[model samples]
Target: MKEELLKTFGAQFETPLIEEISTVGKLAEVPAGETIMDIGNYVRAIPLLLSGAIKVLREDDEGDELLLYYLEQGETCSVTMTCCMGQTKSEIRAITETEVLLVMVPVQKMEEWMAKYKGWRNYIFESYHNRLNELLLTVDNIAFKNMDQRLVEYLKKKSEVTKDNCIRNTHQQIAYDLHTSRVVVSRLLKRLEKLKKLELHRNHIQILEL
Candidate 1:
């Protein structure tokens, strides 16, 4: 676990801080498709992802959810941190995109660590900057990019996150993430297939090239 902390975070964390984290944090394993957090829910703890990925999403009153981004490779979900910090309920949803293992820190420790541990303070600020940049990029994609371009980018991101050239997801699932209809997704996918960019099969999409 210490090795994972160094590999994911860095060697800059003080040994005492690491020891404190090791003591206070509890290990949690979340199965794929499990909701880790939801909108309007008070969170008890924040997770430090050790392995696998979690998808962060925004939802509305109509039950529509849009994929905001993914938290992976030991990254903390800043939205959750914000909610915890402000003593407010979560404004977004988080779900395990894969079988994930994480270290859960008690909610109260967030501020304690910041005031007492330099490493924790740095980690929180870094997490904020990273998440904010990602959100900005997502907004740019939606506001400036076309659907076909966005679809291609989305497919590429999924493949990278899953670490597989062959992605196993249906058109409906893809549509749901992009907040579009299945028909629109299928049409764009067919167009990409015609251009030999990808090969489509039953519940599978094999990438031919970028």
Candidate 2:
């Protein structure tokens, strides 16, 4: 665990901070599509992703979910950090996009490290800034971009984060993430396929043009 933590975060964190995390953090391995955290859940720990990807989502009152952003290896969730600091329930949901390995650092340690480690404080602030920018981009996509454009961007983002051009999500799954109907997603996907942007398979959509 120590070695993995150092490998993933060593460049950004000091050695002492890494050593402390390895001592106090609990390593967790989660399978793909598993919900690691959800709305209203009290966050007890913040995850430091070591491998694979996790998608963070927001839910509406009607229970529709929208993908906010993806957290890749060597990243953490700022929303979870905020919830941890505020002692509040999670307002968003996090699901493993792939089989993920992460170190779960207890919430209490977060505050201690903030005052004790400059590296930890800088990491947390940078996380907040990056997440805020992503959230803004998501809002812009919804407010300005067409559904087809949004779908294309979404696919590109998924491919970039997972490092796979073959997207395995079903039309319904994509629809759910985009907060649209399956029929709409299917139609757009078909249009893209016709335009040679992608190829539709029985279970996956293979990128041709990205």
TM-score top scorer:
2
Steric collisions counted per model: 0, 0
| Residues 111-160, model 2: lDDT tens digits | 99999999999999999999999999999999999999999999999999
Q: Estimate each model's TM-score.
A: 0.95, 0.98
lDDT of each: 0.87, 0.95
Candidate with top lDDT is 2
Query: Candidate 2: lDDT of 22?
Result: 89
Kindly list the per-residue Cα lDDT of model 1 for residues 141-162, writing each as its tens digit: 9999999999999999988887
lDDT, candidate 2, residue 11? Answer: 90
Q: Model 2 lDDT vs. the true structure? A: 0.95
Q: Which portions of model 1 show Cα errors greater than 4 Å?
A: none
Candidate 2 has what TM-score? Answer: 0.98
- Report the alpha-carbon TM-score of model 1 versus the true structure: 0.95
